[model samples]
Target: MRHFLTALLVMILTAHIAIAQSQPVLNLELANKIADAAQEKATSENWNVVITILDQGGNLILLKKMDGTQIGSIEVAQLKAKTAFEFKRPTKVFEDMIKGGAVHLNTMPITAVEGGLPIFKDEHIIGAIGISGVTSVQDGIIAEAALKAVSLN
Candidate 1:
């Protein structure tokens, strides 16, 4: 009876470990959710903007440049998202650092400009989202909406 109980406990612990390993990471899902929500809000507001989602590794996850948005905005948004993900900081924050004479922005192979935010999940950095076109301020507005939609940081 004692041997059987010990084997049963081991099996249960193994199963739990396997389940934990099988859980999907949150970056992709958060990116898709952010992009979809940004697009929905932009459409309703007639605000043409490019939304970009990038994983923590700076890889593109999703992108949407709304109709009427400038073609160049797409690349800009991508760069912004990539910058935020790679640096794990908001692109605007990097820009501010540059303005403060950080002089480090040039060394990074990323755009340290506005329109990017670190996508957060429970205080963890999962990915990032960026917005462009219209105005820089509007970019923040849309991106914030996306974050709020997903209840992410």
Candidate 2:
């Protein structure tokens, strides 16, 4: 009976370790790296923007606003990041749905615009990034470039 109990304990520990390993972690270092990349891209284009990063649990990890960027973009950036984190998908999905006549999505608690993208590691979402300033398409481009720069796609 002692040996069986010991075996069961080992099995439980192994399972716990496996579950922890399968979950992706997002830390400040990674979030800053992503934000830096986004800033660089926006700067290169001479565009001022606001960037927001959120952890998987919908917690704000980082927020950056370039000089001369509109103040309103701050909230928009946060909303986009929150939407992405909450939905575990890019905000563009909602925009696409709306374009396809899913206007009801606008009434939902989502930004429903481009520029929000989920950050993935090993096919699992770790966090999300959102940018606002220029056009929606341009914001999306900046977010994509940031993800690619960090190799977090």
lDDT tens digits, residue span 30-143, model 2: 899999999999999999999999886668989989999999999999999888888889999999999999998878989999999988787778888999999999999999
Off by over 4 Å in 2: 1-16, 20-22
Error (Å) of candidate 2 at residue 49 is 0.4
TM-scores of the candidates in the order shown = 0.76, 0.86
Q: Which numbered prediction scores highest in TM-score against the true structure?
A: 2
CA lDDT, candidate 2, residue 81 = 87
The residue pairs that clash in candidate 2, if any, are none
Candidate 1 displacement at residue 116 in angstroms: 0.8
What does candidate 1's lDDT look like per residue over 42-75, in tens digits? 8888899989887655578788778889999988
Decoy 2 TM-score against native:
0.86
